[model samples]
Target: MFKYIKNDLPASIVVFFVALPLCLGIALASGAPLFSGLIAGIVGGIMVGALSGSQIGVSGPAAGLAAIVLAAIATLGYENFLVAVVLGGAIQLLFGILRLGIIGYYFPSSVIKGMLTGIGIIIILKQIPHFFGYDPDPEGDFAFFQVDGKNTFSEILETVNNISPGATLIALIGLGILLLWSNVLSKKGKFFQLVQGPLVAVVIGILFYVFTKNNETLAISADHLVNVPVPEDASSFLAQFSFPNFAAITNPAVWLTAFTIALVASLETLLCVEATDKLDPEKRVTPTNRELLAQGTGNIVSGLIGGIPITQVIVRSSANIQSGGKTKASAIIHGFFLLISVMLIPRLLNMIPLSVLAAILFIVGYKLAKPKLFKTMYQLGWKQFLPFITTVLVIVFKDLLWGIGIGLAVGIAVILIKSYQNSHFLHIEGEDVDDGKIKMTLAEEVTFFNKGAILKELDKLPENSYLELDVTKTRYLDNDIIEILEDFSTKAKNKNINIKLISERGIVENPPSYIEFFKLRPKTSV
Candidate 1:
């Protein structure tokens, strides 16, 4: 891990810049103490990164969980919510130990893509308000309808009325710097590469804030600036850490909240792990079970020290990967940066404008929801496209879980519809002949879904027909399908349809019982 420091160090600086506002933003969105986000970021970086099997995946306070955390905190109180976070971590650990990691693989690729795209749209919409310095809703709130009673689009209109020229200017500059760095300067030399676009944007934002302090028309208000908790003294800094209330351990509400957090956080983490692995240039696979354990432990530690719940966040993970991170060291280093910055330079960080961060996030969002992705999914056909679009739309209109649920439902429906359509094929051989020869070829895997088709075709067969039941190419025959064939054999006698079972075991003529005949297990060529 240390060997990659040359690459990891620069990447870590980029991730640190990316994670800083997000940590505070998510905490602010959750209605938790501002410092709680920093704590989670630190633990996610140092502890989780150290333990995780992923080389590129980064864990931190997740925006996806902010809504849940917000409600949970309100319902259980801050201290009690910490208890829930701890228990949630424990539950995640249990999930890992039980080897339930494979569950992540069950999500359809379309649904997963939809998730990333939906989150991308959310990021763009949520940050738009901040880009113009609207501060009624917190920085990281991404719901379609906000806590302030305004929807996503309405807030944009409101932002126009409430725009701070200072913030808008800074945001424009930040975006320009980012675009230039990515598109031009970074390609010129090592010096330009070493100077990350986000860091430069943040520095310029800080300088702009300082220079315009006395200007009434261009001064950014406190509401539009990064709000790290500034400690005046050592004692006050230490007082920021809030411990979980052990007495709440006996509360059933605490346990319920814990399970909810564990379930949601683990799911979000697993999904992010999948996305990050795919994004990796080397295509390295992260151990999902181990990731769960790492996250669980991170949450436990984070809660013990007054932090929000942590998960493998896609925003930070994507930023890390895109910034050329080659190892987990970048993640760890970013955590240390969070720790040192908050402890040593909170005042300096507080001077950075939120608009700059919003500008950076905008770029990230665009990359995730690139227009090309839509065309690619559409070209894949509706079987993939429907679920992908549904997930994206639902996520934009509703919440993350709801979007995923509806998307998964649509995906499953597509699968079932295909299964019904392709269950079997009935070819009436030698039509218009005195003796009809019907050939029924079973699909590769004949399940209960094919029973209706097979039954209907059997009923349509003319009297004294010669029917050939072909299973030679089938690798699996469901018991229900076998029963259907068995029952059909008994009914075939009435139609005077002579049945021949053609399979890998050769043919059986007028089989007394389909099950009995199959039990013979005669070996034949494919």
Candidate 2:
């Protein structure tokens, strides 16, 4: 795990920067104490990272759960909500034990690709306002309709009027430095590679803020900077940690909330696991069950210590991957950084400008949704492209799960349509003769979905024809299809169509009872 310390250390710093604002912002959005988000970040990074099978995934308080958390807190109270979180974690552990991680494997590849690309576009769109210093919404809010009552586009239009010259200038400089460090400087020297461009951009941003404090036009306001709560002393810091009200576990609402969190968090974690694996340069597959167990443990620990719900976050994970993280050490170390910085150098951290961070995210977003990928998906044809584009558009317009849900629905519809069209192949051996010979070969897997196609083809068989039904390649023939064939055989006799059935068992001249014949044979191919 420590073999890539050199790579992991730099990547951890970048992830820490990315995770910090998100942690605080998500907690604020959820209507929970700000410290709880940091607690989630710390626990997710260290505990989950240590236990997770994923080499690159970073877990933390997710923005996706903010709305849910907010309502739960209002209904059950904060202490009571912690009880739900603990139960949710226990439920996740149960899911892992049952090996339900296979659920993630069911999502189509097109939808997964669409998810990554859609999130990338969202990051770029959402960060533009922050880049210009008009941050009405929190950092991690990725929904189309924001918590601030403004949608994504309206917020950008609003930012145009409220632009801060100081923020814009620093953002430009930060973006430039990042581009230079990544494109030119990093390749020139090992030292540049070790130091990381985002860290340099952040440091410069801080110095600029400090140097321009007295300047009216150039100085960045505190609102445009990172805000970490400062503790007056150790006692005050310890007081921030709240314990769960276990007595509330008996509340029916608590149980429902727990189940909701467990389902949503597990789904989000699994999706992130799939996306993160795709983003990994090494392409290592993470064990989904292990990931669930790790996440469950993290959430339970976080709840006990007053933290928001935890899930594997794609943004931070992508940041880690883009920053050259090679192992889970990067994630674990980032957690330590969060713990140390919040306890020690929070004042210094608060000096870093949000615009500079936004600049870093701009690059991360670009890498995930490159223009070439759009064309590539298109070239793959409509079967793959429809779901891919649908996922992207819906995600940009709605939310992550909504996008996936709609995309999956569309993908399934496409599959059914294709299946209905290609259920069987018909060949006219001698159509011009008075006694025509026709051959109809069934697909490898014939289900009820193919019934329409088969019925239509059977109805078109000419009178006084010889029909050869081939099932040599078929496996798992649906009972509904067999009933259709039985009815067709009766019709064929009236039309004077002689029917010959061919199968793996043996050829038969119109098998007396289609259902009875299939019952004696294996449903699948031998």
Candidate 3:
């Protein structure tokens, strides 16, 4: 673990920049104080990173939880919502204890890709208003509409009319810094590489805002400022801590929210674990069950301390990898950085412009949806590609979870269709049959699904003198199918035909065991 620190420390800086806006954005989306999200990020980084079995998974406040948080707060009070969060954490811990970590494996690859792509599009879309310097009721960027009730596209139209010239100019400058930071200076030298592009862009954005203020020619204004809440003193800062409402523990809504957050957050975490492992330079696989336990434990602690729900965030994890993180140390250190940075440099943080962070996020967004990424997924197979592209597009146009759900449904449908096709009625082999008495064979594991086809073939076996019913190699035979054979056998007897029974169990004596007959027979090659 310590070894991971040395290698990942550099990468943590990049992750820190990426995690910043996300923390704020998710908090804003959750209808909580902006600092609450930051608190979650800090604690998630420290606690989850330390306890997690995963080497590459990076924990932080998640966008996926934002909707839950928003609805919870609206339905329950903010204090009640905090109770839900804490309760959610406790529930997740219980899940870990039950060893339900493998649940993450059930999510198909297509669905997971759809989820990530969908999230990427959301990040880009949500950031658009901020990039234009229009707050329009600061819910960050998680909705189809502005908090003012204007839809996303309508908000954009409103942004054109209400765009603060100063914010736009600052944003453009931030964009320039981001472009230069990610593309140009990044390749210059060892010295330049150590200094992240987002950091420079942020600094330039802040200073530019400060310089252009009230200058008609430069066009900077008050609305273009970072709205970081300023605490008057230590007492006010410390007063932000929220306690869990034990009374709400029994409420079904609270329990429901807890399970919802745990399930969604855990799924997101596992996907991040896999994706992060893929991005690993050493290419090590993180212990997934162990990761679930870690996240569960982290959420419990975060909830207890008044932070938002947490997950293994991919944006930060990927940034950590791209920034050259080689171990968990980078992830752990970033958490410590968050803890120390907020407490010690609150005012200094206020100096950073949102536009600069936007620039940084723009970079992160580009990395996720890069055209090369599209081409690469496309090459994998249509099974992977169609859902992935569709997911990204829907997620861009609609909601994140909805896009993922759609992708997952489509992926499952594709698999089931293939399974049905592969499971044909009869896989016939041997000489081509021009005669009425044709031979047919069931697959090794035949289910009742194949009964219709088998019945049709049996009906066509004209009152024959010689008909061979071979089940010597068949592993599974459903009772419905057995009944079909029995009916045919009785009919053959009426026709004075001899039906050969070549099976492990005699056609007349096979019992109605659900699935045991299939496994009892040792595979025989004919």
Candidate 4:
């Protein structure tokens, strides 16, 4: 794991930056205390990252759970919610023990793609308000919209109207610097490549803020600073910790919330695992069960200590990959940084502006949903492209899980259609006509879908033609398919064509009609 430190260090830095605002934003969205998000981020990185088997997976507070968190909080008091989070962690741990990580493997690939695309769209949309400096919530609102009757579109317009001239200008400069650093500077030399674009932009943004503090010359304002919750004293900082309400364990609401967290967090973790696998440069696979156990442990600990639930987050994990994070150490180190930075350097931390952070996230978001990504997936083939495309659109229009659900449904439908239309003919290959004899091979499975295709192939046989249906490799044949073959046998006889069913499961030896041909009478019918 340490062998890749050179890359991991850089990647960790980028992921840390990316996670900061998201941690805070998600907390705000969830209507939870601001500190909860940081706690989750720290736990996700350090606790989850430590126990995780995934080399490249970075865990953090998930935006997908924000809505649920908000609703759960509203339904159950915060103290009760904390209890749920702990139980949720336990549930996830149970899932791991049960070896349910294989569930991720069964989720159709198309659904996964849709999930990523959907999250990308949501990120762009949600952050637009932050980027434009139109914060409708009191620097802590993390819900879909402000409680003050402002919606997403209204907030977008508000950003335009209440746009902090200073923030807009600073963000643009930061974005420009980030773009140039990534696109141009990074390529110019190793020196530039080693220095991450977000780091450079952040530095410049801070400097710009300082220089223009009172110039009356900049559009950005001091109020736009990164407003993480900082305690007035050391003891007060520690006081932020909320112990679990043990009495709440008996509450059904608490259990419901915990179950919700477990399922959602587990799903997000699985998605992150798959995504990380796709993004791994070494193509190393992580043990999904281990990931669940790790995440479950993290959530449990975090909840006990008053932190939000977490999962393997794509944004941070992706940033970690891009930044050259070599091992989980970078992720672990970032968690330490999160803890230490909040505990020690909060005065300086408060100086970092949300707009600046928004600029950094914008870059991360762009990289994830780049046009090239779409084009490349398209070129991979329809089998891949169909699900991927649907996933992207579903994710864009809806939230992560919903998008994935849609993609999964679509993917399953495609499989069903293919299965329904499956056949030994369209799938047949190496056909050769020798002395009026034709030979072809069938697939491993012939389901009801293949009936039509198979029938077409049989119907096309020329008069007095000799045909061989190769099913030697076949394992399972549906009754619907068997009926198709039986019908075709009669047609074959009428057309004066010879038919053959080559399979280990063949019913007849010789001197058999279509009915007697494919049906091997059940042995010892009792």
Best by lDDT: 2
Which of candidates 1 and 4 is the stronger one according to TM-score?
A: 1
* Highest-TM-score candidate: 2
Which is the better candidate, 3 or 4, if ranked by TM-score? 4
Which regions of candidate 2 fall more than 4 Å away from where they truly are?
422-526
* Candidate 1, 25-129: lDDT as tens digits: 899999999999999999999999999999998899988899899999999999999999999999999999998876776566678789989988998988898
- For candidate 2, give the lDDT: 0.88
Per-model TM-score versus the true fold:
0.80, 0.81, 0.75, 0.78
Task: Evaluate candidate 3 by giving its C-alpha RMSD to the native, one decimal.
Answer: 15.0
Clash pairs, candidate 1, are none
lDDT of 4 at 349: 71
**Candidate 1, run of 10 with poorest lDDT:** 424-433
Which stretches of model 1 miss by more than 4 angstroms?
423-526
Candidate 2 similarity to native, TM-score: 0.81
Give the range where candidate 4 is weakest over 10 consecutive residues by summed lDDT: 517-526
lDDT of 4 at 101: 85
Writing each residue's lDDT as its tens digit, candidate 3 over 345-378 gives 7666666666566666676666666677778677
Score each candidate by Cα lDDT.
0.84, 0.88, 0.68, 0.75
| Backbone clash count for every predicted candidate, in the order shown | 0, 0, 4, 21
